[model samples]
Target chain A: DAGVTQSPTHLIKTRGQQVTLRCSPKSGHDTVSWYQQALGQGPQFIFQYYEEEERQRGNFPDRFSGHQFPNYSSELNVNALLLGDSALYLCASSTELAAGELFFGEGSRLTVL
Target chain B: AQSVAQPEDQVNVAEGNPLTVKCTYSVSGNPYLFWYVQYPNRGLQFLLKYITGDNLVKGSYGFEAEFNKSQTSFHLKKPSALVSDSALYFCAVSPTLAGGNTGKLIFGQGTTLQVKP
Candidate 1:
């Protein structure tokens, strides 16, 4: 059984540009959540996707959006990236929307130059 | 509102010694607590969780956490530390599953644990 997987393990972008990070949730999982982990900080919830619709979001602005495909894969898009956007973008998958343990992917390291 | 705090920024311990990473949390109803560890550039890995029942929950990698409801704490512990145990640890809390919070998780600032040889 494969665990959660993420694409573009590392990427570099510049200000004003947009970037999309991909994530494939663990098998048998349906809900996916995205998190942003800045240097020397814990991962912060970005948003959550369930039933192909965004269910909940954190303090992030509108620039940060996400989509959950029918297959339970997810994509996190950050538009007009700023230098502060440089961080590790993590994806976690859970079996349902209720509280439970989450399986995480290695994450995509985004560097907004 | 639900939140968590890791009072220590860093903790140092020698190999073979016991280690503890402190954590405290606040929530409206029943608290769902969790601990995750991160190794350099990697995503957080779930270590253990406290939902109900036992106050002491044992998890992978010889990790165990004692959930104290009165003090509102969930501290991670290991019987014997290993150099490889050095990493960043985070404590998290989730609001009642029945509440509007849904699957949201609020993480602590994170504490760095260094198990020296």
Candidate 2:
């Protein structure tokens, strides 16, 4: 089965600009979560989407938002990007039955200039 | 708030030697602990988890973690290390909500393991 997949594997944006990263969950999975991994650090939870709505969120600001479609794909949008926004954006998928165990995609490397 | 801590930034071991990466967690209620490995340019890969079972949990790539409730620690261990095992290891914890698991994970800073042959 195909694992989690993310788009725009690598991209660059300037300050005050906006960017959107896409994710397709693993086959047969319905939940999608986004994480940010800064240099030399582990991933920080951004938010999680289930049933086409954001069910859980982390410490991120309003500038960061996400959407889950009926097909279980997800998109993470960052508005007014800052230099600190530069990091690896990882997308993970899991089912309600297997909640804690996540399958991650290679991640999209976002570089803010 | 839930959190995870990986005490070591880097660990070096001989290829044939055993290895241990320490992790400690803090949570309000029952904590669902997990271990994940990440290679260069790759996402975190699930290793093992500690749920409501035996203290010892085995996972992919011969990785095993021992959950100590009293100590609030989950340390990943391998009987023998391999050069291929060199990568970044992360410890994460999810709090158990009254309804169910929120599927949210709090991750540690990560520990780099170097297995030299």
lDDT of each: 0.90, 0.94
Instruction: Give candidate 1 regions above 4 Å deviation.
Output: B97-101
Model 1 TM-score on a 0 to 1 scale: 0.94
Q: Give TM per candidate.
A: 0.94, 0.98
Candidate 2 is scored at a TM of: 0.98
- Candidate 2 local lDDT, A46-107, one digit each (tens): 99998999989999999999999999999999999999999999999999778589999999
**Residue-level lDDT tens digits of model 1 in B1-117:** 667889999999999999999999878788688998989767788899888999999998999999999999999999999999999999998777555446778899999999989
lDDT of 1 by residue, A1-113 (tens): 99999999999998999999999999999999999988877889999898999988899999999999999999999999999999999999997744757889999999988
Interface RMSD of 2: 0.7
Off by over 4 Å in 2: none
Model 1, residue B41: distance off in Å is 2.8
The candidate that achieves the highest TM-score relative to the unseen native structure: 2
